[model samples]
Target chain A: MTIKDIVYIALFVALTAALGLMPPIAFAGGALPPITAQSLGVMLAGSVLGAKRGGYALLLFVALVAMGFPLLSGGRGGFGVLLGTSGGFILAWPICAAVIGHLVHKNANANIWVTGGMIAFGGILVMYTLGIPWMAVVGKLGLDKSLAIMVAYIPGDLVKVVLATVIARGLRRAYPNI
Target chain B: MLDLYTPGTSMLHRMSPGPKMAALAIAATALFLQESLLVTALAVVAILALYRVANIPMKTALAQIRPLMWIFVIFFAVQWYFSGLTLAAYVVLRLAALILLASLVTLTTRASDMIDSMTRALRLFKPIGVNPDKVSLAISLALRFIPVLGRIATEVREAQKTRGLERSIIAVAMPLAIRAIKMADDVSDAIESRGYRS
Candidate 1:
C-alpha cells in the first residue's frame, strides 16, 4: 500500500478511537443500558469512507478491542465482552458497517437527510437484532426483559441517528471528496 | 471517527474485499461456535501473524491496544470472581481473535473498495423494492461522520476544559448536543445544495 493510503487509514482509526472517548450516557437500566454517541463513529465511518473503508474503520476498532483496548463504551473490551451480554452488538458492528456502507455507496451523492435516515435506520436495526438476543442469553433474562432493556435505548439511538445523518451530510458538504 | 486503515503489501492486503469480508464472517462464526481455549489461542495467534504480515509496528499496534489493558483486567477479575477463570479466558481470547481478524482486514483494504463491494452485495434486496442507492448513501454518510464527530468531540472537550467545566455532564452534553444539532442543519443545507434529494 502507498504511504497516502496508510495515512488515511491511520486517520480513520484515530477518528474511531477518538469517538470512543465521548462520555457514555447510561439510562436507568441496571447493569447495561445502551450508550449514547457510540454509533456516531459507526455512521461517520460508513458515510465518509464509503462501504469498504467504513467497514474497515469499524473493523479496526474491533481489532483494537480484541487486541485488548478499552475503546468501546464503558471502557469495556477483550474477548469477555464479546461473550457477555454485549457480544451480539459487538459482532453486529462490521455487518452494520457493511450494510450502511452499501446503502450510502448506492446513492453516492444523495441529499444528506435521505441518506442519513437510511443509515440511522439500518444501523439501529442491526444493533438491535444482534444485541437483543445476546442480552437474552447472557443476562439469562427472558426475551421480554431483554427486549425491554433494548427498548430503553431506542430514543437515544434515534438521536444518534439524526446526529449521525446530519454530521455525515455536513462532512460531505465541507469535504466533497468524502 | 473510524479511520484506521494502514496500508501494506501483505497477503491479507492482496486478498479481495469479498473474501476478506467472508473470512471475517467465518472467523466470527467459528469464534462463537467453538468455546475451546485452544481454538481461541490459535485464533489469537493467527490474528497476531496478520498484524506482522501487515507490517504494523508492534509498538504502534500495542499502543493502540494498550488502553484496553484495564478492560482485560476488569473482565478477568469480574469473570474470575463471579464466573470462573476458564470462562473469562475464553471470553478474552475469543474477542481478541475476532478483533484481530477484523483489524487485519481493515489494514489491508481500502474504503472505496469496501463501498464498491457493499453496493454490489446489496443488489439482492432490489427485488424487495429496496433502493440500493438509498441504502448505500446512508452507509456512506455514517462511515464519513465517525471521524468528523470524533474531531468535533475533541474540540468540545478542549473548549470545556478551557472554561474549567470539570468534565461534568452539563459541560460535555450540552455543548455536544448543541454542536450536533447545528452540524445536522449545516449538513442538510449542504446536501440540498449538492443536488441531493430530501
Candidate 2:
C-alpha cells in the first residue's frame, strides 16, 4: 500500500470510532430504541474506500479494540467485546465492509438503488448471518429467539443503509477519485 | 481526550503491556471455560483486589463497568429467565471480571508502550511481506485521529445547526466526510514531504 492508502485506511478507522461517540438518535418517538451511527461508518468505509482498504480499516478498528481502546459504543472494548454476545456482529464488520466495498467498486457508476442494496445485503444480510447465531450460542437463546431480537434492529439498520448510501454518493460526487 | 491511562508506579503499571495482555487473554478464557460460579466469583474478588494493588481508585475502576451496567442487567435477566439464577450470576460475574481485567490493562499501560509491543509481535509476520513500521504508523495515526475526527464532527454539527439542518444526517455527514477526506490527503502530503516512505 502507498502512504496515501495507509493514511486513508487510518482516517476511516478514526471516522468509525468517532461515529460511536455521537449520541444515538431515537426514532419513532422513542418507541424503538435509539439507533447508533457507528455502523453507518462501516457502510461508508466500504462504499468509499473500496474492498481492500475498507476491509483493512475495519480490521484496524477491531485490532484497536482487542488492544483495549474503549472505541466501541458506550466505551466498551477489549477481548470481552470480541467474546461477548454481540461478538458475532462485531466480528462480521470487516467482512461486511469488504463485501460492500467489492460490490460498490464493481459498479463504479452505481446509483442510489445499487449502493443501498449493496449496503443492506452486506450490512444486514451478511451481518445477521453471523451475529444472530453467535448471540444464540452465547446467550443460550434459541435461534428463533435470537432472530426475533435482531428483528428490532432491522428498521434502524435500514435507515443506516440509506444514510450511508446518500453520504457515499455525495462524497463520490465531491471527490470522484476517492 | 484519550486519557484512560492512569499514572501510577504500582506493579500492574510497571508490568509490560505484552505480558499483561497475554495474562488477560488466558485469564479471560479460563473465566469462560470453567463452569463454576464460585470460581468466577473468586475471580471477581481477585480482580477488585488487583485494582487496589494497582493504586486505581474504586470510582475510576467502576467507571469501566458502569457503561455496561444496563447490558449486564439485561443479560442477567434473560439468562435467568432461560436457565436459572445461578447461571445468570455466573455469566454476568464472569463478564464483569473480563471487562475489569481488560480495562485494568488499558488503565495501567501507556498507549505508546502498547503500540511498541504490538509492533514487536507483528515482526513475526515480516516473512509475509508485512511492513511492521507502516502497520504501527497506521495504528498510531488512527489513535491520534480519533479525537481530531471527533472534534471535526462536533464542529460540523454546530455549523449545520446555524443553518437549521442539524437534525439532517445528510447535511452533517456530507460535510464531515468531505472535510475528513481532505484532511487525509493533506496529512499524506505533509508526511510524504517529510521524507516518509510507504
Best by TM-score: 2
TM-score of candidate 2 versus the correct structure, residues matched by position: 0.94
Score residue A113 of candidate 2 by CA lDDT: 96
DockQ comparisons of all candidates to the true complex: 0.07, 0.68
Docking class of 1: incorrect
Per-model tally of clashing residue pairs: 57, 0
**Candidate 1 has what TM-score?**
0.54
Native contacts conserved, per model:
0.03, 0.65
lDDT tens digits, residues B1-198, model 1? 233557777787788888877777777777778778888898788778768878887675564445445445645565676668788787766655665566566556776666677678768877976455654554455445556766677788888888888466456644654565456456655766778642
lDDT by residue for model 2 (B29-140), tens: 8887899999999999999999999999899879988877766777788789988999899888877888888888888988778888999998999999889999988988
Q: Report the C-alpha lDDT of model 2 over A84-109, residue by residue, as the tens digit.
A: 77888988999999999999989978
Query: Each prediction's Cα lDDT score?
Result: 0.64, 0.87
Candidate 1 residue-wise lDDT, A1-178, digit = tens: 2222322444455555555666677566534443656677677667656777677667656754543345676554543456556678877786787788789878877776778777876688877887788766653344776676567678877777776677566556655654
